[model samples]
Target chain A: MAFRASVVRLNRAIVYTQNGDPAQVLRALTYKPLPPPAPETVNIKYLLAPINPSDVNVVQGVYPAKPSLTSLVDGQPDVFVGGNEGLAEVTHVGSGVTDLVKGDWVVMTKAQAGTWSSSRNVGVLDVLKLPRVEGLTEVHGATMTVNPPSAYNMLNDYVALEKDEWVVQNGANSAVGQAVIQIAASRGFKTLNLVRKRSDIDELTRKLKDLGATEVLTYDDLNDRNLTQRIVKEWTGGKGIRLGLNCVSGPDTTSMARLLGQDAYLVSYGAMSKQPLALPTGLFIFKNLTSVGFWQSRWYKQKTRSDKENLFKTLATLIGHGKASPEHEIVTIPAEDSDEVAGQKVREIFAKIAEGQYGKKVLLKIAGSE
Target chain B: MAFRASVVRLNRAIVYTQNGDPAQVLRALTYKPLPPPAPETVNIKYLLAPINPSDVNVVQGVYPAKPSLTSLVDGQPDVFVGGNEGLAEVTHVGSGVTDLVKGDWVVMTKAQAGTWSSSRNVGVLDVLKLPRVEGLTEVHGATMTVNPPSAYNMLNDYVALEKDEWVVQNGANSAVGQAVIQIAASRGFKTLNLVRKRSDIDELTRKLKDLGATEVLTYDDLNDRNLTQRIVKEWTGGKGIRLGLNCVSGPDTTSMARLLGQDAYLVSYGAMSKQPLALPTGLFIFKNLTSVGFWQSRWYKQKTRSDKENLFKTLATLIGHGKASPEHEIVTIPAEDSDEVAGQKVREIFAKIAEGQYGKKVLLKIAGSE
Candidate 1:
């Protein structure tokens, strides 16, 4: 902390000149450090930025969100820096910026605001101040802004689920899915978690049950008509599921939709299968089903600053108590690494993530490659 | 009208003992007429009952709304009577019935309440008394209960559509589609209607446009990528459609969903193609699209009697002033025909309906084969 005030640091960022294969397009750029915060702006040095799946899509030009592009990099005309969610330390507060100051921890409120950078000047509104974080880990802090809030909003926004009420979701092994399981479980809500069929089915089932899941079954289990019927008939007493969170879409999503009773809602946040949701119109007609989508970026835009802060406070409390745990793998980038090596490291990590091999979220523990 | 109060006519109903092909399973039963309505009930003779596609489904036992089964039929132990929507003339009102009287006009509020029967006793709450019927046709009186209200509700329930705002719907030639066109037109809203590619598509387009459609295109238009994109970019100037009414589900339904903008709602009332709605998860997540189903039967159950009556009155007035018209084929059954002939006639009409030859709605004009 004392070194930051005494010495100036060069800012290095993983920026892309064009959208395509992440490994081929992404590169590290060394840029001049900030002078001081402009009015209403605060300079933040990103402590940790998680490489999410959607971040890959943003680089591939397939994602809906666009990254903030800048020409400030010393040799680049314009480049988009990767990473959407990050934990940062405020280094210098801009004139008239009272909400944030040096040494304060904050999270990005802006979507794709180029959090992959070491440090940048940003309007105070673009970041939300994290409450005292004595007990929370940096990984929890970095991953907190995206997946947890999404899980919280998906459960609370669509349906008012009562205690012990059941929620069915696919991609149950995904980051957001785990958060949903923990959050719903904490609310006394039961979850029917569906995942892809794997060899370690029993182990995955046990893992989810430990997270307070009432039932854990692979998508293959839904193929048996009798078993599917029995699930609603015996487990829910035919009340059926009212809320379905889907990240994997295809015929299996159709089956998941079938488990929903009349007047139910299916909220889709991702398409892990990259397949369309082939749902029978009868679910929407006969069963009065509704299929909707949820985007964390959209939620952030629509909600008030206080709404987000309150959510952050609540989730931090839960995470502090070890009630909600998000599995993350941290990859460190030392401050003195060469530009090519550091950027290559980021590109390779993203390539592995895009291929789904990184199974858990990967957070970059980076200050800069100075 | 004079004979209704004086004569005690025998009752006859088209009943299905079991579900299967309507041609093979439907039978006409000549049951004893009502012996004065049993407290708060009223005796009504159906003037006309619309043999909807759903009615054919009802006989096939594929429809969602179950037909009311009665065991009082002289020969059958228990039988399900066909027909859902009807306009009946009230006769021999029971002692406790004050809202209805002999010779009054009424429509069934109950879904699949055995309206195919010539005369039967129904609870007062099961029927809504028509305000006045002097200027309305029997077809309008009969068809009004289902499609118009469905069209009205689908437009109003999901989106707050303003005048000149566009609504997109497939099944442009359907009875409900025509109603949607007229009702939307009456409200100063425009419609982009899509229909199947048939030999008479041009003629169908002309007909729909005559009924107040802004644009009528064959589903094949959606297959053209440039045209579909143009519909949103050119016609709407990227304001994109906010409400889409889908009946034909499949890939085409997916294209219709794509036409919708962010925060749009796709209200599906039926699935004529019997195919699933294959939608990309991105539409819901990035675009904030919501796909929901609309069932007129569910609407009947959820809304108050007066809510229905208000809609009925509004539609009836519209029908009275020639603002809206539903095309229907009235097939009459002579009062003295044999039960075998009458039953066979119904089965044949339904077979034709199921085969889609009856492009227009088929209304059964029956006092019964007494």
Candidate 2:
């Protein structure tokens, strides 16, 4: 079986001979064909891929993991294939492969580049079986591989919360926070959500509440020290909060730490503010507080094969039962378009995400079927 | 059998009349007597009491728990009693008390005042049997009730550290940190100790190392970013740290958080700096870090009776085995001296402590030993 792939012939990716900023950094161009899948590799017909903030970071050379430069296409010296993971259909299985058949939906389970292309070959182990669910579409599966799992593992691994216990998280409107709200709610736990105050905060709050948030609050609510204290006291019945999730660190992180009960856990995952976290020592000494960091990539890599299998099974069950659904915006790009055009679209969408303009994930449609 | 006690009568505690503080607050006068112990109370012959920071906070009307005002004394008003808990010999058991016997060494296991006096009547539940360990003095026993237990619980409760695992803590020169160093070492765990750069830091580091510190360093060492990273890499074998104990919050907390591995726990228990904790959110999201607060008093209050008893037994055994000892400075106050003289001595010692001239705990020795 043969399919055309927008392979990186050289290191050059999304290049323009005429250079400027974003317009020049990501130059769309055509690339030469790549070799077929080798033994133990499966050629995937890329269906859709999500334009994530980390993807933008990767292009900017700030991401922790960089794609290997050796895999660049022959002619494109400055360009490299960039997408981390995406949903696809099995086009051709290598001689050694037995698990996946043609037309089976799969997603990259590990760090794999060239996901922005129409087709790419990846190791069998790097691909996860995407069980077909009635309501979940290809776009949903494309976007489901990262943020949802991050939220799921963080809430489940840190603290074994009771049904009535509360989980307070900043960035409540983000995809991960939203997933957390839903997953926590489904597990019989309550969520106290914190998001930036917008003109449509009430509507946003309503949306989140409908998604299983017990309480939706703005950063303004957390900033007013007295009101924050009062709200925390009332909500926690003076027992104080048990778990505080923070992505927006700064004064807000310190405030979250203060509002927690004795021995409460504060888990931080992102620094949207790019500011250092300032927490009071009293929170540590007098409160017996524990602060820890979480990285999904590292956590997933560290998990035993059995644990990973169990997690995937659990996630599959949730998706199959409609308890967990991806909230995504799908943008279909034609397979005939140059690789540069597709890269530009992903970059534009990611820029909006970086600016906090986009609320939902942006999925790039690659396979014509999707 | 009634024994003479230099009790601070209600409404007539010694007070500082001026903001100049020490000299002004030294006056002590007589008032009416306190009521006898209530039912289920045990009258204790106060053997020794240790002056603690909380006691000073209380005298300044800054402590959280405020004592009630009463006119049972000679018409004086607004008087406050000092002392939290102390080692006492059971002198008289009230009607409902069955666990305590006369001549047994006991310590107040709960919040109480009036330990400065020769005797105090407290609830039987609020007192614990102090096992007779050879060479354990009453002064040492009084000091043992808080810091040692706090260190023990903080280290044991937060991380399930293995024998070869390392525990890092700041304020290594502090009583609690020192205790942690010893306890962790005795339990076959290594300690990466961080202390302020004092004039006697070398001596202090040596002493701490003798007590169980694997490596003793100063904040200056942590200030060099590259050096800190290298040290962390070497200490953890590039795997990352497991537990970080912080009492000094602020920018220091951020450093501590950064040094931790994924899913590592940072426990805070004290704030000598009186500064808020500032940390980056990357530690939370990317590192899977957890920050939690710890309060020994609150923890003690919440434990079951049997658990409390077991802790005491374990602590006593540790002390008996010479694994732990309270460093103290005993200051004897004659019972025959006027209340004013006794008050002056306390004020002088407290002044020295405030001035940072004292290296060990101040133990008040009340005259009239059994």
Against the true structure, whose DockQ is highest?
A: 1
- Model 2: reference contacts kept, as a fraction: 0.95
Give the lDDT of residue B354 in candidate 2: 86
For residues B1-370, write the lDDT of model 1, one tens digit per residue.
5544455577788888889998889877787767877889988888889887788778888777787668855565898888888999887788878878888889989888887878878889999988774578777888878888898899889999888899999987788898899889888999999998889887888888888999998777888889888989998888799999999998888878778987899998888788888988888998899999999989999999889888888888776766555666788876687889888898888778767787666788777433
Docking quality tier of candidate 2? medium
> How do the residues A163-245 of candidate 2 rate in per-residue lDDT, one tens digit apiece?
88888899898878988888888889989899887899989888898888999877777778887778667878887888888
* Model 1 CAPRI rating: high
Instruction: Tell me the number of clashing residue pairs for each predicted model.
Output: 0, 72
lDDT of 2 by residue, B72-94 (tens): 24545654455676788887677
lDDT of 2: 0.71
- Which interface RMSD does candidate 2 score? 2.4
TM-score of each: 0.95, 0.79
